[model samples]
Target: MKARIHITLKNGVLDPQGKAVAHALESLGYAGINDVRQGKYIEIDLAKNDADTTRETVERMCRDLLANTVIENFTVEVG
Candidate 1:
């Protein structure tokens, strides 16, 4: 099984890096670049075969280490 995870900052959290990217885009004449948000993408290969169990394990990983639950939210895709 393979697990794909996406981690992103929660709403209302300040994202300095995102802001910097937005500013750079504007400087490059990329007009109408109103905003930007940055996030993380991770792909994991697992030996487990059960889809339900793999999803549970991935969710646990996100809650424990993959994501900062307080400031970030994570979504998981299992295949």
Candidate 2:
């Protein structure tokens, strides 16, 4: 099975990197931009073939190490 993970900051959290990118875009003449948020994407290959088990394992991975549970949220997709 393969697992894909997306890790992003929760709402109300300040994102300095995202802010910097937005400012850079605006400075470069990009207009009408309101906001920008940055996140992480990760892919993993697993030995297990079961989708349910793979998802559970990946979710655990996110909670334990992949994401900061207090300030970040993660989503998992398995195939």
Candidate 3:
């Protein structure tokens, strides 16, 4: 089984890097550029045989080592 995980900053979190990128784009004369935010992604392969079990394990991984729940959120997809 294969799993894909996305970890991103929670709403209302300050994104200084994103703000800098936006300013740089404006300096380059880009039009209508609004804003940007940065996030994280993780992919894993599981030897477990069931989707339910795989999701459970990966969720645990996200909580333990993959994402910082203090200011971030994570989602998991299994295939």
TM-score for each predicted model, relative to the true structure: 0.96, 0.97, 0.90
Please identify which of the two predictions, 2 or 3, would achieve the higher lDDT against the true structure.
2
Model 1 lDDT at residue 41 = 99
* Model 1 lDDT per residue over 11-34, tens place: 999999999999999999899887
**Against the unseen true structure, what C-alpha lDDT does each candidate score?**
0.95, 0.96, 0.92
lDDT (Cα, 0-100) at 44 in candidate 1: 91
Q: Which ten residues in a row have the lowest lDDT in candidate 1?
A: 26-35
For each of the candidates, give the backbone clash count: 0, 0, 0
Candidate 1 lDDT: 0.95
Model 3 TM-score, all chains together: 0.90
RMSD after CA superposition, every candidate: 0.6, 0.6, 1.2
Winner of 1 and 3 under TM-score:
1
**Which residue ranges in model 3 land beyond 4 Å of their true spot?**
none
User: Where is model 1 more than 4 Å wrong at Cα?
Assistant: none
lDDT by residue (tens digit), candidate 3, 1-79: 9999999889999988888988998999997977788788888999988999999999999999999999999999999
| Top lDDT model | 2
User: Sort by TM-score, best first: what order?
Assistant: 2, 1, 3
